[model samples]
Target: MTGTGAALTYTTIAGRHRHEIEVRRSRFIAVLERVESQEQADALLAALRREFHDARHHCSAILIGANREVQRANDDGEPSGTAGAPMLEALTRRETADGRTDLSDVAAVVVRYFGGILLGAGGLVRAYSGSVSQALDTAQYVQRERCGVFQVSAPHATAGRLENDLRGAGLTVRGTTYQPSQVLITVAVADSSAELEVFRERLAGMTAGAADAAHVGCEWVDRV
Candidate 1:
């Protein structure tokens, strides 16, 4: 799916993270993990269930797909819309530092230990949402984007300088290949017509119109 203003990108969790909160003597543990498919999400829930076997309730929410089109929530043993629904809302409404709310390919499971006291529906919603939100606040994030690959061929003597200049200009230098007579410097740019044109212009300026870059392919990459 496309992102803001022709740029295709979304925010997602970097890895697995766990956090716990206590409300009215009950313990809520939130586990957040990156999952690319429904099968992976299911595996995550199964593993958590095995890990916290004695928990009173194990509510879960999963969002899978680049556009976050796959959404699933289970209230488990709690009242309808009290646990899983709020947790899913927390995942959907999370914003990045740059104010983007498109978080995808992730799963959240909230395990609750009853602690003898019964909480009302409203209280349960707040506890579930708060647990996931707090865990998200402490998690590391990365951007998943579709990027274009380009190969810039340069002379062996000046290839190093060209690579350094490309990096200095905030381009991702994927790798360098040594050829018989020249070197191929692989670079990645956002996969948009505007961005590709800009890259061509920047390369021309960097090489003084002496070198050209050929578009190779497009790929999705995670950027920190």
Candidate 2:
């Protein structure tokens, strides 16, 4: 599996359970959602807040992008590290919410409304973290693939045939561009150099050595 050219799905813990702990005069509700970007994370948080708008505070934390490019968290009003940090830690625990695995780049938000019970600082940490654990109890997750991007170009006359052949060979076409005399096709191959050789040979044969292809960068793509 290490060098087989197959994309590795990240392993996460499995099970479904929720934990609840009380905080200082507030009850926090944490919901965890696996997301791909800051925008998607924000959208999920917004939706959760709208559903529980009357709550006192809506603290959030998000980690997104293939490289975990964007990471942010807010305490809302609970003492600096009491709310968001704990919630983020809960989400990053590499555990399955349900029975699935391969979780990455996710966001976790904790919503609080005064419960009229002072749970103190220790309680706040436990409560905020517990909320996220609760939401994961029923969440679903899927594996993702890291792919290598490539671009192939050929004369317009051979474009259609080349495209059909590539598809039949199980290559994922990312995008296509048509120019005056040639067609450009962008594709994503599995993340191994060996796979690129196989693709290059097949494409070359399909186009009778007239078409040329080049490699682009690698990107994380949704697994089928």
Candidate 3:
């Protein structure tokens, strides 16, 4: 979580723990899920609230981007820093599931229902933090890759052959557009100029120099 050059791997905690930490008749239920961005975190939080509509508190926190650039936490009316901050910290300390030395964009949400026991400020922190920790223990994660988009254009007659060739060569096809005489194919490749050149050569040869490929912008894609 501290380095600047390491690739990000997604991971969670290893086991589950659920205990009623005293907090003025309220019990915490932490839910952790890997997310790609703040928008996804927001959507999940909204869904959880709706699913558990009668719960008393739905506090949440999210850390996203390669550098963990995007971060947000909400106390949801808990005693100031008691709910959100601790949850964020727990996520930060938790290692990715793959055992890779990479950081990831992740989010965790903790829900609390009043249980009639007062856990005080320290206890509140423990309860909220513990909830996310437990959920992380059982969650699944995958690594994401940052790639570049490329488009290739060829005649309709050669489209099927071109598509099959590209897939056989291990290039990911994002989309394909059909025209009366040609087919436009969109693909994603690793963000390396060398790889692009290789792709071009292979594609040109496959289509007998009848097809030409162009580079588009870069995109963050899920690594398969």
User: Highest lDDT among the candidates is held by which one?
Assistant: 1
Cα lDDT tens digits, model 3, 1-224, are: 12357443343222222333334667677766667767878888998899878888899888777667777889998899998999888777776744543445777778789887777889888888887776666565556666678888888887887888899999988999998877899988876667778887888789788777777776766666
Q: Is candidate 1 or candidate 3 better by lDDT?
A: 1
Tens digit of per-residue lDDT, candidate 2, span 105-183 = 7777777888888777888778877777666656655555677888899888878888888989999988889999789
The residue pairs found clashing in candidate 1 are: none
Per-residue error at 42 for model 1, in Å? 2.8
Residue 61, candidate 2: C-alpha displacement in angstroms = 1.5
Model 1 TM-score on a 0 to 1 scale: 0.83
TM-score of each: 0.83, 0.71, 0.78
Instruction: In model 3, state the lDDT of residue 166.
Output: 92
Whichever of 1 and 2 has more TM-score, that candidate is: 1
Could you tell me which 10 consecutive residues in candidate 1 have the lowest summed lDDT?
A: 1-10
Q: Which regions of candidate 2 fall more than 4 Å away from where they truly are?
A: 1-27, 31-53, 96-103
Question: Which is the leading candidate under TM-score?
Answer: 1
The number of residue pairs in model 3 that clash at the backbone is 15
Cα error, residue 74 of model 3, in Å, equals: 1.6
